[model samples]
Target: MTVALMWEARAVAGRGADLLAWARAQHLAGTPLRRETFRAPQDRVLVITWWDAAYDADLPELPEPDGTLVGRPVHRWRFEAVD
Candidate 1:
């Protein structure tokens, strides 16, 4: 099965660039099949990772950024691919 994990976070005021840089620097213990990073208005950052594993399988995820850099807790979700 194919699973896609989504992680999103919002940065504090005037810190969008810093947040984006921090997210890009993170490294997971295991490499995903595919990975991509995105930024949006309101200083939001998103990271999506695709993995060749079961929906419930244990997988590595990006850690939370420093409190000073983010405005709120990160949001995350996982989805299983379907034809």
Candidate 2:
């Protein structure tokens, strides 16, 4: 089974671009089977990474970006494939 890791963050006012750039440059360990990013209306950046492992497996996750760039702490979710 595969697991998906979803990480999200909101940037400070007028800093969305910088936050997106920083997210684009990030590299998570385990060499994800697939990775994607999204931007929301409220200056939010969302990153979803698919890995070939169980949800409980120990895998490298996207590290937190500098606190100065974000309005609040990063958010994360983990999901296991259903099938």
Best by lDDT: 1
lDDT of 2 at 71: 96
In candidate 1, clashing pairs total: 0
User: Could you give candidate 1's per-residue lDDT for residues 16-50 as a string of tens digits?
Assistant: 99999999999999999999999999999999999
How well is each residue in 14-56 modelled by candidate 2, as lDDT tens digits? 8999999999998765698999999998789999999899879
Please, what is the whole-model Cα lDDT of each candidate in the order they appear?
Answer: 0.97, 0.91
* Candidate 1 root-mean-square deviation in Å: 0.4
Output the number of the TM-score-best candidate.
Answer: 1
TM for candidate 1 is: 0.98
In model 1, where is the ten-residue run with the lowest total lDDT? 13-22
